[model samples]
Target: MADFDVKPSVIDRVRDRPRRLQRLAVLIVILGMGLALLYPLLRDRHGAPIEVRDVPRLPPENLAVIPLAASPTDDPRRVALGRRLFFDARLSPLGRSCGNCHVPASYGTLRAARSPGLGDQLDEFNVPTVLNAALSPYLGWKGKITSLADQLHRVINNPRHMGSNWAWVIETLSADSDYRSRFSALYADGITRSSITDAILAFERSLVTPGAPFDRYLRGEFGALTSEQIAGYELFKDYGCIACHQGRNLGGNLIIRFGILEDPFKDGFFDAATPKSKRFLKLRVPSLRNVAKTGPYLHDGSVETLEEVVRLMARYQLGREMPEEDVRRIVAFLHSLTAPLPENFR
Candidate 1:
């Protein structure tokens, strides 16, 4: 018989190696070849490190949640300029600034169910908080906008929102000596739409709120969360709420159908009279970073309390009936996710 000829590819050879040696080889390759090859293996879909824990029957290697982190720093001057612009109502024809809706004290969102826009028009959806918003891959209830700059532009141009345009904004800002000086110092383009959006985006990105109790627990602080909160976390994962609400921002990274097992809107929690009620079946999951404060909850802001929302999610999304005590514990766990106010939040 002729000599059998066989040759393995590099990947096959590497896979055939001893497990420890294979990992070592992978590490070597990852270091030399860049992170793209190894990143997917080590991280989740959201690019957060995949963790393992010895919890109930759930797969140890499949833990979905990760601790939140502050966004990368932008140029201080740019951030400052953005911050100034964020609060300056002069950008709007109606003198309604971004800060008017995203109030700092209210967790970077409004206290009302819906925010008022340029005139008497009310926003169709609840205002998602700007705190830790940088961690979210997408913005708004629909997850239609992918970048902060784009969202800002939409809000500025939308008649229901800022009701203004770049021409008007540029003219208004250019007339101000202070804005001119600030623009001259930071940007070569000087007060164009892109520059304005960049400045505001920088300020918005800097609104990260870290040091939540849940984050502390994730960092090996065993005592950071109370016993009930701990139990609630277990329930949160076991009940499958962690499916859509995972990653650093917990929920903002995903947009899933509002009801998986049942129709949430049909359960009487939704108001038919609300504007665009038919358009909300599929929506982005809002981040629960400060859920304790960012209410009333849900896309339409129809659900008022965390406990009620929890029960509704369990029944609608998970198709499970949760006891009131379990709901309380889950709400307690959510409370641990609230971080302290950011510096200079006012």
Candidate 2:
């Protein structure tokens, strides 16, 4: 065998090699620790355990119903035009329409604690009811929107909601011959973004809950509701929920943070798995009208059943425990809030 010897390369003797490896190892450890700290911050906030007894049974008078807005019947043509635009799916760039989230006949599908967005991803907050929405002084869970017209424009342009800008919306609506003719007939400005918003608002303003058993009861028909439902109504009032929820709409007058009296955030009730922000705990108290049809209760859609919602309110809001039977009765009363859909919307 020939004698062959090899010498080490100059690069192998560099002083920075050990130091670089050590830095890389330290970086890896720090990154791992950071992620470990963030795991709980990214978790869901809806699965907190609730104590049922905390909520008080408010008086029936305190649980005022939400009142419906006046219809635009004075201008039948504009209202008719608006209704057509509202149902048109062409309003969205992605081909999804408002009705996709706010189902007209279904207690407003958007009324759920958190409606699914374009591709089934959950929305950040619960969808408020369109029923009597026009009567509300403010809109959204945070009461960010001030007027129906303004809210219409915001939703139409919001990337998460309608996913289109004003120009695109106007252009899309103008392209439809029916919309063009209606716009020309209704407004002097023809098919513009403002007109589109006005039309949609007109239609939304007309979404009123028809006479329900509860409404009939309110009208002095004592037999409109069953004994069990009446018992639930009593329980609803006996609870102190009336303090914040009282109004023609049963809610919407004031803003309150969830878990205020009791620590709702302690058990991860408000964004339990997500990073803590003051916004997560603040929400508009929703109207109880037609609540039976709207399921997956609460802002995060954590409570699957109305019974669970009642129990949670008792524990978290009322600061007391309620029997399962009482919760069931309360749910029964809630069912009486359902009313028939408007003829035009159907």
Candidate 3:
């Protein structure tokens, strides 16, 4: 055989060293990037560990849902004052208050398909419950308002809602001795629109219902849910209901087209003449917490039963029909989501 050297010369070895180092550097960079991307997903929305009852379980990163935690720091006094204002009918010029539609006993919603507005006009969408609403990233069926304070202001001023402006709200509230006293104690500015909104928002933030069976299950209580509900939960994920409906509030964080796979509104109230931009077609996915009690369901409140809602969601959102047994199990899982109203809800 011809003499052939298998080993590279010293010069070749030196030349190859930088290439090897470059490849190793690239690998390290890729790994670092991956970890950086995954770290945020592993943490909850607030960048805190996903915890409930001091038990850290599946973070929003892993499960697409986080356990609801108690808001222990909420001021009881502020909550009380806000609760009082919430139910008072004087907030609206028409004598319809927030509570008129967002009834506490009804899981913060009304039974009507659409609530009557300030005048003869009826609201275009269903009333979503205020329970667990604090966990929602977006508010209202349209998902237009980002802040609770802004939502309150818009409702107070919207012609279809309170039909009143800041001036009227302030004047109406300022006349009340009790409100005035509470305002003075809680806020130095007292009786301003900002103060009123702050108080109401403080109360809204306190409306956290953290003790649902599903929440307990997430907190490490494995047996909190019944076997059927557990089966339903697995089915819920398997059927892709968890895609949009995830997070602590489950569905509130997302704004999706009403009919993603098939048009739920076609041949119904929404015709081709309705603009694509219209809210009737695009809406915020509502929270499922206390969903069993907050029906009539859907944005238009067209579906009356939870079972029907599940079937409709499967058809319209998932582009398929679920078996009756699967629907029953999913509904059972949803029932596990129901939590008691906050103690200060009334």
Q: Which candidate is the best by lDDT?
A: 1
TM-score for every candidate vs. truth?
A: 0.80, 0.76, 0.79
The segments of candidate 1 whose C-alpha lies over 4 angstroms from its true place after superposition are 1-63, 273-280
Tens digit of lDDT per residue, candidate 2, span 135-216? 6676887777779888887887777788877787788877788777878988999988777777777777777775878878
Find the candidate with the highest TM-score and give its number. Answer: 1
Candidate ranking under TM-score, highest first, comes to: 1, 3, 2
| lDDT values, one for every candidate | 0.84, 0.73, 0.83
lDDT of 2 at 332: 93
Candidates 2 and 3 compared by TM-score, better number: 3
Models, CA RMSD each: 14.4, 20.0, 10.0
Compute the lDDT of residue 202 as modeled in candidate 1.
88
For model 3, residues 249-331, the per-residue Cα lDDT tens digits are: 88788788888888765746444565655734667888888898899988777788999999988988999989999999999
The C-alpha local distance difference test score for the whole of candidate 2 amounts to 0.73
Residues 283-314 of candidate 1: C-alpha lDDT, one tens digit per residue = 88888888898998887777789998999899
Give every collision pair in model 1.
Answer: none
Candidate 3 Cα RMSD (Å): 10.0
Q: List where candidate 3 sits over 4 angstroms from the true fold.
A: 1-63, 267-280
Number of the candidate with higher TM-score, 1 or 3: 1
